[model samples]
Target: MSEENLRAAADAVLSRLVGDAGGTARLRVDQWRAVEALVVERRRTLVVQRTGWGKSAVYFVATALLRERGSGPTVIVSPLLALMRNQIDAAERAGIRARTINSANPEEWEAVRLEVASGEVDVLLVSPERLNNPDFRDGVLPELAATTGLLVVDEAHCISDWGHDFRPDYRRLRTMLADLPPGVPVLATTATANARVTADVAEQLGTGGDTPDALVLRGPLERESLSLGVLRLPDAAHRLAWLDGHLNELPGSGIVYTLTVAAAEEVAAFLRQRGHAVAAYTGRTENADREAAEADLLDNRVKALVATSALGMGFDKPDLGFVVHLGSPSSPIAYYQQVGRAGRGVEHADVLLLPGPEDEAIWRYFASLAFPAEEQVRRTLEVLAASDRPLSLPALEPLVELRRSRLETMLKVLDVDGAVRRVRGGWVATGAPWSYDRERYDWVARQREAEQRAMKEYAATAECRMEFLRRQLDDEGAAPCGRCDNCAGPRFTPEVDPAALEAARGELGRPGVEVEPRRMWPTGLPSVGLELKGRIPPGEQAAPGRALGRLSDIGWGNRLRPLLEQGAPDGRVPDDVADAVVAVLADWAKGPGGWASGRPEAPARPVGVVTVASRTRPLLVRSLGERIAAVGRIPLLGTVEYSDDAVDARVPRSNSAQRLRALHGALTVPGTLAEAIAGGGPVLLVDDFTETGWTLAVAARLLRRAGAEAVMPLVLAVRG
Candidate 1:
């Protein structure tokens, strides 16, 4: 087909698809104009809308416009499995022949390749990992090169190290397209991007030859129904208890964010003790498990979820009421992207943050994990350059002669450096281009340093948080996000649960037995693989502080510290605090607190604990599980279930009478969970972590219309 004639055919096909998306698919004037501009201008574009400002609409319109021009099939690269599935579903609903491919099933690659090459597909959604395949670059992409339409890179900020969620492979995308036929256009989109990431996209696309015109599309950040708030907790125990008490107050779906995988699991366990339906996700988990977690959250089968930075990338669940951060996030961009998942689907939402001083230490630890040493970076690049083809870690191990763990660390560092590529079965040398530009290597190093500095700044920012994010994401025209922590005062007020305190008061002197689970510190917790005998270690009182001290006295402090302070005390204790503590402990031990049932279920046996934390609402375990397994072709929801029997012991503690009195003293105020959910009042939905907005969708729908006027999400960070 002639180029001009082909372009026309592609355009026509896309228009037909757009028409099929229903009347609701029509883009607003501004959004339509943005899509037209990308097509007509042939330059880089940045679309920064609020959670639901028709960002997808802009991309869909752009996709149609490009496809109609007879450019063959357009490639839409996204980070989320849910996004790919949903986008494909939307395209099909709109009558577009949309197909997607990923690493989930190597067996299906041939069929997908044929579909792409035969031009039987209008659009193809793929993961960056999939694109790194030599067969992909040399096999399918070239088929449509002569007529390939628009290459839409979603979440484009991932290209920059400075981006909130940096994906090392994203930098290699431009390289993969280096051989594409002329006239093929690229459209990059992101809800959030810092100046550096936006510029990187432009530079990679060679847009406007160093003077690409960037567009700013703004939507209302002022969500009246979404009240923003922050919670400053002194310890983990009180934070957790507070979380348990407030879980039901959340509208429907929510997220709780923690700093580490261990923290995610710990927070989830504490919540499960109260009979909350929760699931967890982390990078360490198998893709199958993540798929299940995503499914549960989407179907609303699981009410809560705990996870690290891995849950939100491409997942989309719009009915969230709140997103909560259990600790401080690493950067403003990360925080913004994570919480942006809330208040989606035209419902009210909340973003909340609960930061402790230790948050800084936690962030630093994360930084140390990703920040590679120069020697490691250089060695990784050298090995990959020496190999003619992709190599797995085992194949390259002898080349480096480093310990397996150390080599893996170097590979991770290299992956972040964009110097390495992770193929389906092996790693490849993607950095030969880096060798030609030593300065680029230096730039990578310097950019990493700058990112660390930015992380520090984000953690310590005193200005309006929304403003900080706007600047970071290159939304220079963005005004103060009047809804965030920096623009508004603290939303989390110092309050207590009167009913809980009253209960505490009456139970404090009841002479209830204490279990290790209720201890101030979870000391002598059995290590993984140990059998549970329902035994408490000797000399360990089940009091919160003493237990913690004992755990710290031993080598188990790191594991117990965060769990103890999951929720800070509300300050309303009864006269017989001791009795209340014992009563609470006893209830927990006998009921939901059994070690076998204390944790939530997972697809596989728990190798260790994993966490899912968010800021706005309670975690969305069911929805997250559904999406993770939804990869391109799988229907994992309702097919998989989880078991929390991995937990070995339940820590129990006696509530001292004095403690009960203190708790009682602080919880007499109004606006408790009951009050907020009753009559017209504010109801805060809290979670441990939130990456994408999906986790908070349910809560937003349930609480926004009830007398609860507002839903807020406070999270530690947002993954890119």
Candidate 2:
């Protein structure tokens, strides 16, 4: 087909996709270029245009033209559920049949698969994770790959480890791409990709040379509809106050992006208290709840949905009016993608980022969750190689020292590298020779550090905010956006309502978080030197406890984290923080689930206090215990002692099995403290912080064995 014919076909489909807003919507020159490359030339392509540039239209239009030519269905590898839903709806608007198979809709998968096999579906949407499913990867994918007409990888930047939001599962697409039959045109699209990420993704899109080299349709990255700004508040509370005061003035319903799930919930709750109709959306939110939240936001029933990065991509509300960040993301690319969500459908949308002091701490914590050291990678491979059968994550977890989340991530990477394969039962070694990619991993780490610095510069830069972000993406055309805080002369002010500020302060200052005791022993504990498994013996368990806050909590947690930090100098607890702990204890005792609630289910009131031994902040721990004991009018039982080897045993980074093994004999209940505990009531077990809860669990067991009726653990902070 000629470019004229492609443009005509694309315009007709675009009319149906957009439906009568104007008589017939026409594709722009670049959108037509992407469509022409895919349909006429049948070339692989990558579209890196700004948000709202109709990248979807390029593929949907191509799918229509190709299907008119009797091509098989277009298979899209989408990243988020919300994205899939939006694309499916858009496909139907264009009169194209679309089906989806994602983690959320497993029940409909068989029906969708049957439709696909029968050639009844025009477009099939799936998550990147679905590409890694054992059955699908081994069974459905090959068949789907063979007969597919067009392959669309939405959010293609994820295919590159260098992308801001890279996922190990996404890289698995390379296999399918390599296997794709020649002449099956492929298209990858993203609104946010830097030069490095764009290069990597384009290279992969042209993998196996099934088609001509990728025709890259790179465009400027500037959202003129978005008016960007950064409001640097003094603290989390003041930021909340700013939102409470100014949210309604920011045009239409929008998203309030937060740095953490806890912060999202906290801000959502605070906003609701201020009488704003809002909901919190996070990765932790249930599928049904997330769906409802999305629906509410779409219909403008809520002013905003407090969200983390979970709501980043695939949410389509073209008329979204505003986006406020409680804290800035670590990367400018990531920030651009999120802020892109707004102003896509509207002429002008407010984009305000409230950068807090805690942003760096949050970034560092997430950075720590990336690829583990090579030693861990090597040991994981060796363990898999020695196994006779596939090992489930539970069984494999004990053999490796990585946490469950980290372990799963590592396994995904190994699967993509051909060093491992996930089968029906679990994961198995493929016996593939895999050289550790130390250089690649180090390079990615360095890139992340660079991105972090870039993000800091973004917040601090006096130049146009959008221009700053575009420059970070290596867009040579970047210039003054003329719509940012700096260029537009401060469209928003930092002044917050006094009443709202006080309310925010009160909400944040009020503190008490439940520390649910670990009930069952971690899986494969016996794989270590311990003989524990299944439900923990009730008598040996610690009672449900309390903490002043979680390290990620936007309230007291932000205040307490520094003092309880690992290497902080040993000093007595500050009077104000000590008072907060006392307040938490008071609330926990009298609260609904408290031992002092006088309910029949409540445990006997803690009769005394026993402080956990801490090597790093002994003074802080002892002082907190003394304060609690003095306030409660209970005896200050002696601090538990750590054996000589406890330091090595209490490795903070180890998994549950290794940590428990180290703690097994390293903790000793002082004979004197044990005597005090004998025949006693529930006692308050105090600690500066609990990372894995192993310390509290081990100490509680010893106290229980010694004769305490119950042990209630309390701490200044709970490490998230």
Candidate 1 Cα outliers beyond 4 Å, as residue runs: 1-26, 38-44, 207-226, 285-288, 380-391, 398-468, 471-492, 496-720
lDDT of candidate 2 at residue 552, scale 0 to 100: 88
Model 2: per-residue Cα lDDT over 1-720, one tens digit each: 666766777799899988855646778889988888888888999999888889998899999999999999999999899998899999999999999999988999889999999999999998899998988998899999999999999999988899889899998989998888888899999999989999999899878843567889899887889898888888878988889999889899999999999889988999998999999999999999999999999999999999999999989999999988888899889999999999887789998889888788888888988899889989998888998988888887778888878999999999999999999988999998988899999999999999999988988899888878888999988899888889978998889999999999999998788888988888877766678989889999999888888888789878987886656688998999889888888888888868879999877788999998877888889999999999899999898788766656666566777678778888999889999999989999999888898889999999999999999999988887
1-720 in candidate 1: lDDT tens per residue? 454553444444445545643333334666665666666665455665555565666666566666665657777888877678778867875456787788776787788778877878888888876655557866665664556677778888787655667765576576545655554556667766655665666666663334444554444443344545666654555466566677677767777777677567656765665588987777766888887887888777877667777765556777766778777676666777777877776456777777655565555444545444456557667867877777776555434434345565456545544667676667876753543345654675566556546655755577765555556655646565666566677655545465543432222222222111222312111221123223333222111111111111111223223433335322212223323333332343344433235555211111111112222222332233222223212232121111232221111121122122222212211233233344543222322333223223223333333334433332222221
lDDT of 1: 0.53
Each model's backbone clash number: 177, 2
RMSD of each: 18.7, 1.5
TM-score of each: 0.62, 0.98
Q: Rate the local accuracy (lDDT) of all candidates.
A: 0.53, 0.89
TM-score of 1: 0.62
- Specify the poorest-scoring 10-residue window by lDDT in model 2: 644-653
